[model samples]
Target: MAFDGKLLANLSVLAAVVESGNFARAADALGLTASGVSRAISRMEARLGIRLLHRTTRSITLTDEGERFYAEVRPLLVGIEEAASHAGGASLSVRGRLRVNVDPLFSRHVLAPRLPEFMARHSDLEIELITRDDLGDIIGEGVDVAVRFGFPPSSSLVARQLLETRIITVASPAYLKKHGHPCTPADIASHTCIQFRDSQTRRPFDWEFHKGRKVVPVTTHGPLLVSDAGTLMSVCIAGGGLAQMMAIGVVQDHLARKKLVQVLPDWADERFPLYAFYPSRHHPAAKVRSFIDFCLEILA
Candidate 1:
């Protein structure tokens, strides 16, 4: 097909439909009628001699061919939009939907409280945040950026280090008073320890501690194993057990109020690095770049 204004318009419509999940929603997003959007998609399919979507009365899904085609065209569409915005000199006016995937603990404790400021700064941008502990397939899930803990594996996406926070072992003051504080990592075996399980792997996270250039991984048994850091913090606050958690997840007010006490402070030398990951940036969207810079500034 020859590259022209009409072809670009139709491609834009196709991208919107796939992103929004329905013709009506895509039309609303693009300031077109539902019938107009549907006609454009039908025209494209007829021209290409391929069905792009499997549609029913209630829902619509991409066909296998549609998925591959979208993957190939989506980045090109983004590049075109960026080029157009630069041509018009509208780079400062960042406006679009930004989908983010974040760890549950980071979402609740670190990002959630600070989101109002970010939204206020970029009033034109729309945000959709999905919080999960496990690292999902970012490209397949249509995530613009993902905030994750620990080191991410090598992948197609670009990874930038946000920050590293210390992991502290903590328990309620009442529990520590009743059970006595642990003097060494080995002493945890005699006390109640709270555990966190990997949501994707279904395996408990090993409690790591460092002392004088040596790192140790301790296996702990607990009455409760949780997949969420917030819930694990709550259990620990109620004197359920000891928990090893990132400093970002620890409530400073709780520590000041003596609701939670840091145990093994000398041994709390392990640090976990947080990263913001996104797709390749041959032509990075303004919305994604702006949001990432905003987060880095806030977290700095």
Candidate 2:
């Protein structure tokens, strides 16, 4: 067996087969016959002298060797895609299926409303917004980019910090009137506090406060626990309990008529940084670069 470029080509084909689940579906995507696809897989394994797939009539799965090979070649395949896109240069008007994963609240409150402008700017680009509270895997999920909250994972993916968001301790005027305002972190224990427990980190909702130079975490409890910020804000507006909210999420109405009151102004620290993350820079696509620049400009 010679270590030719065919190894890379066959690895790509095998990756497609594994990702698409079956030979027929993989062949459909690759525009190859099912037999051709299967042959490629067989040749690949024979060349490498390893069994890569556990195949049956109805299903197909990767062997341990296949998994390792797939992981190794996955980034290479992505690089090829980026190279092809970059080859088009300015002639390519960002015209591709661009899948993005974003937080549900940000999608609804911020991005969704402003999407028409972006679509109008790039008519050829197809945009699909998958809104979820669950943290999405950009590479694993086949997403072009992901809008993430807080600090990004320490990886090769580029994280462009967009904004320094504000977090505020807030409650409905009614709730505050009934329960009274908490003057200190210790006072939170006496009041019912709304909990956001569905973070990707799976940590309990602990209200963090910054008083002077000291930072403290106040463990409190509420009757309700929520994942969505919009829903949490709704509950707060409806007099649920005191909860900390993103300033953008609560600012408009809170500032206008005061349905919600921002409590403990001095105790609140800055919110986490939001970022637009994508893969490597080896093969940079014009459209992807344009989109990233556009995001930075708009957010800045």
Candidate 3:
């Protein structure tokens, strides 16, 4: 079958519909009327002799054929768009949807607050930020970039070092006043310690401390064992217990505000590295590159 401009246009509409999850939303995304989008899909289905979508009163879902077709053609569609942008000399225009997967704590404490400035700089760019503790498959999820702790697990993707932040032990002033401050790492055993658990493993993170060349991991217990860093920090600020956290923007803000006091400052020595992981594409979309650079600048 000869593929014409109309077929390409309908395919684009189909992709928009699949991405947006509905006819109306897809229409809005493509700047077309709902009826126009529906008609385009109907035309494409008739021409291709395949039912692309299963439509209910409330929602629309792709048929098996539609799913397979989308999976094969979506990347091609993205490439075509990128090519058009480059051909039109709009390669510098950061105008597209940018889907990013980010660590929950980093998103909450660092990226989220800085997003407005990034958006203001690139007005045409749309951002979708998914924050979670676990690092999911970025390519499978259609994520352009992932801001995560540690290095990228798979060598298939390109990884860039964002920053290495020091982990510091902290406690609320009220908690310290009530229980007395722990001057040494060994004294942590006497204090109520808030523990952070690995989301995947369900094991508590051992608090690490260093003096000169000697480093040790101290196992401490508490009433609260949280899987979320933000919640753990909140509990510590509310006088729950001593918590060790990455000394990033949010922690520094809290420290400066006197909300949380650094405990065993001399002993805090562990560094957590953050990375920007993305697909190993030869030419990433301008939006992705722009956002990564923006993050690096703000984070620097």
Candidate 4:
């Protein structure tokens, strides 16, 4: 075994490569030539006697060994950088990227509007808010945290209860006036009800109602099926159909402006819990902690 700095360099290069997903891009990011990056990987593989990456013209894929090595070394590199910054007395006012996944409606009407205040408080923090209605694996997706509706899944993740949400049925006044109002759960069967379909569940959610110590599920028919809650709310507002949505999502303007009227007020269930989830709680980063605290303070 000879002394070689190439091993450490290659590890860094490998991280860059994986992060960038291409040799040319990785080289550009690392300020190295593409051939130089390839040579580094080759020499490092020769030194370690292992194939770290599978390369092709179209794409690069990491072998099992490459993945193992990356998982081991990536955190070490991050630690080294953090230690260097710590030794230099880096500012503690929440710096670094905060990757958050949240609902589109929440992101649009709730979080995005108030993000400037958070950004002002954390001047050094760079927040990347990814909006999606679909659920994602936070650990696999490399997200810092996610704001999810309902209870935490049966995963080894840490979750903090942020807010309680109530499901409500809403319909436009014009639609209700033309079609008349439904008095009971059974009335939904004949009316045009907007159905919200979950991608993961692959099924339309039935309108739920409660009656005097009894639970009733109504299977409604509708011409419009929607995945996005924003669109569903819009369709309901435009008199397309009646929809069941979270109170928080539908309450602000409609309840005040009288565009959408809440129906079945006494019948909807109150099982929705908004949660902020992270992969782990063991020595959480300051950025994650600050975001969670903000959500708790503002939303809870």
Candidate 5:
């Protein structure tokens, strides 16, 4: 039997399709036509005499035989890329397309403002910062890393604590002036407090004030309910209403500029943790490590 020269290339195409969830996207990633990608899969299937993909008009999934084959081939594909990188002197380089999934608020206010600095430091790096309401399938979607508030959502992914920010309640000077200042957390209910709905849960968040061991849950209501952090912050800055937000990051800038002022500081003891999550790998690539370190430096 002849050694198949196209075996590795076809396997790579299959891996790309699995990572991208569709052939069109896989083709785009690999610089190939969609029909070309389809043909490659077809060739591999015919050669192996097994069905690899279950195709529908809208979605594509791996068949059992395909899944087993992919499981065997995935590591080889990864290792080949690493070997190629090492041979090309790119193993030590922080130069590759680094796809990061991040929160919308963090992307807009925190990362966007400071991204130029990172880009300057890593002139060869191509960074793609994708902002979505929730953390999607990082492994399946080919994401390098993800930064989000709170804790790790899944046990499968390795998580690192980037920073911890105090949960602070704030209001613009004009809003406080017009609505009268709420000296106590209890008094917030009487004023128009901006509400932020949780992305995972459609329900609005209940405000909480904390001081050491004491915790007070404050039920808040407002004329407007929002699901976006940027909009909530904007409304608070523009004297729309009072809002609770992280004291650091963009909120610190607001405080420095006198755009927003912290209210009830004595009771603001709760700290929100920010984490960086990545899929587990024995020998993670240089680009992934570089990105994670950069995040820690910025968050610090």
Candidate 6:
């Protein structure tokens, strides 16, 4: 048999059903009725001569054959999407549904502020930003792009460095006045220091301060521990304890406003990197390219 356009169309419906985990949601996304979605799947099953999904009244799961087929189909779908976006020349193939996995801090403090301008520039683009603490199976979750802080561990995805944010040690004025400011990096061990939990390790990261050519590690002990950057900032601002924070972005505003004062500036030479990751580097979709460029502009 030759190629059939209807079969190609059904692939998207299948993708939507598997991604959304239900026919009703898949139908809504594709602008079809639930019964219509059911009919389309039935047609696909008949043409393929295999049950792709183990369907119950309440749930849907892929059969072993369907699992293997879907693995191959995912890459094909991604290629089709990228090709569609590049149909037009280099004027930015920015027209498409862009799925982004964004770090919470960057989403709230950086991207959210400039979103209106970005959307205005690309009227054809539709953005779906998912803000979370960790990057999990972007390909499986259908994420087109992801932005995160720190160096990404080894991965097959292309990670582009967006910025190297300066790191600073800071504490509120009242807290410093009561506890007395530390004079050197080693003195930090005697002072209460905020602790941040590493997402992958689930262990509190050791506090470190950097200077000209020296890196000093200070064992930190604090009354509180937190996973969220916002919570860390909040407690530090309330005169709770000393914290190490980024010197750029909303984090810097506290320093400028005098709500928080930099401590041990001599050891504040450390920098944390931020990166934007995507599945492919070759002929990336216009949406991915445009969004990354937008991030570079704002973070600049």
lDDT value for model 6? 0.89
Residue-level lDDT tens digits of model 2 in 1-300: 666787777777888888899999999988999999999999988988999999998899999988897888789889988997666664455777778888776677777767788889888788888887765678888877777777787787887777778778888899989989888878887888888864667765568887667888887887888777887888888999988877774356665678888888888785767777877666555566766677666665
Against the true structure, what is each candidate's TM-score?
A: 0.70, 0.68, 0.69, 0.69, 0.69, 0.71
Worst 10 residues of 3 by lDDT: 84-93
lDDT by residue (1-300, candidate 5, tens digit) is: 776779878998999999999999999999999999999999999989999999999999999999999999888888988988664654478787889999887778778888898889888889898998777799999998898887677469988888888999999999988888788889988888888887666778779999998999998888898888888899999999989988766788889899998999999999888888888755666777887888777777
Query: TM-score winner among the candidates?
Result: 6
Cα lDDT tens digits, model 3, 1-300, are 566999899999999888888999999999999999999999999988989999998989999998887889899999999988665543467887889998988898788888899989888888898988877888898999888886457569988888998889999999999999897788998888998887546788877897667897777879888888888888999999999888987889899999999998898777888899889767777787887898799789
Q: Highest lDDT: give the candidate number.
A: 6
Structure candidate 5, residue pairs in collision: none
How do the residues 1-300 of candidate 6 rate in per-residue lDDT, one tens digit apiece?
798999989999999999999999999999999999989989998999988999999999899988988898899999998977567543456787999999888898889989999999999889999999888889899999999888887989999999998889999999999999999988998888888887778888778889977999888888888998889999999999999887766877888899999999989889998999999878788889999999999877
In model 5, the Cα lDDT at residue 192 comes to 87
Clashing pairs in 6: none
lDDT of 4 by residue, 74-191 (tens): 8988997898777444234478888999877677767777788889998888988888876588899999989877667788989888888778888999999999888888888899
lDDT values, one for every candidate? 0.85, 0.79, 0.86, 0.82, 0.87, 0.89
Instruction: Compute the lDDT for candidate 4.
Output: 0.82
lDDT at position 13, candidate 3: 96
Segments of candidate 3 deviating more than 4 angstroms: 1-92
In model 5, the number of clashes is 0
Give candidate 4's error at residue 13 in angstroms: 30
Which consecutive 10 residues in model 1 have the weakest lDDT in total?
Answer: 85-94
Higher TM-score: candidate 5 or 6?
Answer: 6
lDDT of 2: 0.79
